[model samples]
Target: MLPFFTNPYPDELLYSAIARYHFYSGNLDCKDTLEELFGSRSVIPSVEIGSNFTILAEKLGHQYSVESLLTNHTIYPYYASFLSKQRQQEILENVKGDGQGLYTRLGIVAGGICRKDGLYYCSTCAKADAECYGEPYIHREHQLQGIDYCSHHEIPLRKYPKTNDSRIEYIRFELKHMDLSPLYEIDSHKELAIHLAKQAYKLLNLPLHYLSREQINSKYRTLLREYNLITSSNRVRQQEMYQAIKSTLPNSFLQRYESAVNNNDEYNWLRILTRNLKRHVHPFRHLLFLYFLQYSVEKLVDIDEDDGAFGRGPFSCLNKAAAHYKKFIISNVIVTRDFKTKNLIGTFTCSCGFIYSRKHTTDMFEIGRIKAFGDVWLEKLHDLQQQNLSIRAIARELGVDFKTVKRYLIGNVEIKQVKSHRDNDDILGIYKQDLLKEIKKHPNLSRTALRNKYKKQYMYLYRYDKVWLDEALPERRYGQNTIKKVNWAKRDQQYVQEINRLHQKLLQSEKPIRITISKIGKSLGTLANLEQHLNKLPKTNKLLNDIVESVKDFQLRRCYKIIDDLLENDQEIFLWQIQRKAAIKSHHFHAIQPMLESYIEMKQEVTNNERTTS
Candidate 1:
């Protein structure tokens, strides 16, 4: 039936665009489209009216006459660009001659990496400075084939020449190492997926109509099992039962529908479906059928059945029954990690128009529980400790906590764990060693990177938020410890920083080390003599060992002396200071160390005495 009409566009192009849309939806009804266009506030009116626009207004709303569509001025700009010489050249070179298939023809991997054309790779290139630079060539792959050299390095492509076959093999070899799902090993997850599919079927189908409890059980026997939500079974018994019940429902049931006008014509399908559901089934009860349907259709298949295509009037009341199933499929399914907090989240909406949402927190939650649960408990305890306002009063004002506030602050609360100040993918030892080297050179680097570097021995660490430190300095517990605090403290910045770097070498190390004071002063970088430096060693050998054994040896043993005159002023001379070196703490130091001169002589004397005794 013709609904309404309106002239909404000014140009031929605009009318043509509307025609194309009608063609796509298979709807020639211009009335509905015009009605929607007129109803919206933001849709703007076209500039001027022409014959094309007039024809669009009067038509069956089919696309502009096919003849007019072939030559529209609106698309000329894009087509015009194709005529350019440069563009034509590019098209010629890139376009394939014999089209295998548009999709299969163009590929990133099939053409690019499979061919073994010799190419430059920075990682495998000659690293000039490292000892391996001149060493015998070691192939990154197939080392048994010996040095696989690229031509760019001025080296001959090894005994094995680079070939397309080799390149394709390499591509496949590299691809084989990709991490893939271990689903093949887990049987339970797949079983659960199947069970959920059957559940989807129940949720999607039940809204056909509502019935009383006794009628539902006697007529639809399986409805009771579905109603209780006992869905863990590997099988669905309700499909057969529901089909039987639906077939037996009498036509007189339409009399139960509330709408009086819809008795003969102008049927309100949604209203009738709701009426049946209210009378015979659980409200929103079709959600079970929807879940089951979702579960059964494996990842590849989609359900497109339209049970409610025709209104329930004279025949096919079952189709009339299944109409109101759309609303149950509202939210997209969210699958979260096992941890309550997500390391990853998978969100999906299936093609069946049925939404299955669940939060799955994987093992990461267990790890967080280990690290964060204690802190969370402490936070609860602290909140409980502070009781200036009554919990009820606080809840009234802030809208959240009476007990929760107390729990997070006073009881079993998780602490706000500062993530470990380390990078997971950092070049491991290289990063730390490089940072120590940087600090040695640029000890007073004001803007050095704090993200990956730490200053050792003699650095003054100050971030923009200026709680400052230089060599074993005491940090202030109160505010104003960072750069933000120090900018205003014209005089205190230097002094506060001096105190902060004081304990840079705080951790105790297990290795014994010998400090050659004479050689250390050889560079004589600063003006200290061997005697002056050695004089700073601790009074007892144990004290000296403790000082020297620390990870930061030189600074801790003597640097503290300069800080508070920790050394009581006996600035004499000496050759060297000796302390144990760091090695695997699992073994005795002597057991692992090379025999010393003193140990060798002791061993020789013991051997002679053993011989005499024998």
Candidate 2:
């Protein structure tokens, strides 16, 4: 063992501590020092060092487990909360064995390491470290990828000039040895950078417990529901959720982290988070989601065992007269299952007679629909009335309508209940005779026609007097005997003639007009009828099919034409010009790129040969 080894600084990486040890001990040879500390010289030092914790502990004459190093020094806590106990164990085993192989599988580099390209350090921390410990050291938080600022100081982190690309294997470079450049603080990104830094710091420093994938998924779903990003049946409003996330995070921050969700992509990280937890996501991505959802690390990791139908309650009482008004003591939660919609309706009630309900799926809750205020809320108007306050004044004070204040003042504050279908049966019975007379007067009229004339009566009869209504207005039968026959042969000949005329017109047109079925069909409104009788209109079908072009074929033809025109005009044959003229989407340009290139080469060769002959 070495004569002396320094204990790791607060939030300092194990590798950084080892590097500091080498600096203090005047150990110039990196391979030898690594062999002495880790019992093997084959180990490569990474930003997040692992595997040799036990060996290092043994060399230092101390007892320490791999978990202690991971928790106290590395960025394990950020990922630990999202991983299952088994997965966490696997990570520990991988780190203890190969060290670097598990990072990719764990999604650490999923977003790609574009922003964090070097060894970063906070200048303030570097100066403080030099002053206090007589030498500057590398901080664990500073080394975290995508973290650009110091969480404590809120200053931009500076990167070492050549430490990241140093040729010396396992180089023990301290902060004092390198020339640190000052990082300019971007005002707009400062807040976001600080937030990211703080979150990253928490992950590196905190001792977070392991949470299962199911637990994390549940939390995300709950947040989505609360944000109204999901429907009653638990279907995600993808567009809305996308828009919400876009609006929540700044474009610069997203671009910096490479976590921006594209509008056209069907699958994105946000959507992936909502899916089943079979795959592990990157810890940075988890942080992004948690930040977007406004969930702190503590809230995310702490799974509430009592999250039942009414567990979210102790919801504020809506009834103003109740002693526990807005005190969140109300616990009357009734869950009603709607068989037709397959929806669960949760009705929350208070002792003071205020009630509210929401429709949700079996596993989800519509928290946004949880209305605490009820008719009892109007009781506040009573106090205003006693004070002789104007309706407008009361309305403004309570943030309600003046009309509502007036109604409550007149003692018309009773809550209105919705009338059920059964309750309307009596009213329908009164109009039964009138509905029958109207149907008889228009016996030739169809059910839809009759319903239009007597909408309310027809709806009631359709629901209650179905048998009578069906008898009075029987289903219309258009059998061969009753139906008007069409001479399809004659219609087919006429359509063929029209199609020929249109085709001739298209051929005669001088401009580059696209000949599509829809364009021809629009000119001939009876094309839908012709399409229906394609078997009988074989001549017309053949004529239309001859001119029809698939989208790819049409785009390629247009592209060729555009290139030919450009060549004839002696203009530059640019890809953008071809794309714009052909109306081809940018994504499809690559598919036909080789063909275009070959054609361009051949045309240029022919032109050169003609020029040489001339």
Candidate 3:
């Protein structure tokens, strides 16, 4: 009296003593038994099978028609993968029952099994062989553990997988988050963008083989996860960069370009950035690689080309990558002395295919002014070379992602280290054989006792001599010292040698100027003549002859103003008779202000004086 559905196979099931094959192992009227069993027993099916025999043929993996074979196995008109015309002819000859089966072949997407309604299910979707979960007996209970389920399909969906390939792909799919209005991250180059969209259509929209459904589902699941992470993170960073750059653009971001001021467009800066991206080597080098990846890709079943082998030599992946990023060399960039003069302008093409020019000039004398795109990339590549810093330290110092730093460092440096595994350390051989002899002699010696015995007595023997131990052990010669006395003595000698080096350096240096307390007064008196007119003073102009050649003579004359201002600061300094009137003066000040009480009196007196003088 066991239950009818006792031990169901993971994929296939026949109800025996308890919903298994032994009960109906004889293939006893599949149609009639199902009908009788449904009517008699209240047993529920975990999976539902379809009614049509043609569907049964497909679920069980037998070809029924040409269309079914082509779509199901990825077989095609001429350039097909799975089945040839001869195979199709054989399938038609062997598996097809009648014209009725061939008529139903048009339905399968990537395969001939449909589980649209809640009754019929594919065993791949369910845990049963060729049973439809979405149709009549769709069981949500059969969904995979730890995942949300389609009530229709009754299978667990893949959420995450433990692999790098899946992780990167999952980030790529989170791109739906990038749907900020109508803007799109067209790949670094528009051509790559166009090609990628096509690949996206093929990969995302098309279905995989029914036989490979497990593989396909796994791949897509991983892709979705990676896509989510990549798009979300990059979109956030891009938003921040856009906001930052927006503020620094011209005219409160209303005008970003020289032309924007003329045209008064709000998005002129964005337009300019887009135009510059098309022409710039910075984006284009990355662009070409993406473009090649897209264009060179074929279906997974396509033959691997000999010419496309990666990491070979000469015309290998390295060479092709180098050639791919080679720049269009433009020469003889002109420079002008004045910025406002006619100069070479950086040219750019816009997204709408119009050229924009900006006022920029390349220095004719500067060496790296006219480098190719490949040259600039090579310079960036050189930065990853191992010079002084460790990889982690370099990444932290440069403020770049660890992965980005690791990519370059691994490519340029790590590979070299791995190839040259040359370790030249001394081998102080640890012979465990010596310990076995002591263990045999003293069977129960405690670890401390063993150590004391080995050191005190064994060391007194020839191999580990006590005479040598007395000389080696610090307690015998220099007691109560933390560091070994010999090591301390050596360090002390090094310290003395360093002191001698510093003394020699001090002797080599010239003696500094000695300042006497009396020299301060004499220096101030002589420094006053420096305040006189340049032509009146002896060699005042010659003293600044070199300085005046680079800067104007007016600037040289201003140097004397330093002395004039300093002299004015001293109240004890003598003043000369002035030809000007009202010459009563304050020290260090250009002029004295009249008091508030004397203001009106001064105005009246000054007016009277002017009138009297006239």
| Candidate 3 lDDT by residue in tens digits, 49-110 | 11222432343343233344333322121111123234334434432332233312221221
Better of 1 and 2 by TM-score: 2
Off by over 4 Å in 2: 1-4, 22-29, 52-61, 112-115, 164-168, 175-183, 210-213, 221-230, 235-237, 277-282, 288-295, 298-309, 312-442, 447-614
Which 10 consecutive positions of candidate 1 have the poorest summed lDDT?
Answer: 312-321
lDDT of 1 by residue, 116-185 (tens): 3332121223233123322222122211011122322322222223323321111111212222221123
**Where is the poorest 10-residue window by lDDT in model 2?**
361-370
Tens-place lDDT per residue, model 2, 1-614, is 55678788887777778777767777777777778788787777766656656666667765456777788877667567667666777777777765656775555644334446667778878878778987777777887767778888888877676554543354444654665554565488778778877887766655645565667777777677667665544566788877888888988778767777777755577676777644556667778888888987667656454244345565665444445655777655666555686455777676545565766443222333434445455466677778988889877776556886687678765654333477776776776777778767866777777778878888877887788777877477575787677888887788778878987797566555577777778888975765566787777788778886677766776777778778888888888778766767677887888888898889878878998999
Flag regions of model 1 displaced more than 4 Å.
1-64, 67-335, 339-387, 395-401, 418-614
Give TM per candidate.
Answer: 0.14, 0.56, 0.15
Report how far off residue 584 is in candidate 1 (Å). Answer: 60
- lDDT of the structure predicted as candidate 1: 0.29
What is the Cα-based lDDT of residue 386 in candidate 2? 84
User: lDDT for each of the candidates?
Assistant: 0.29, 0.69, 0.29
Highest lDDT scorer: 2
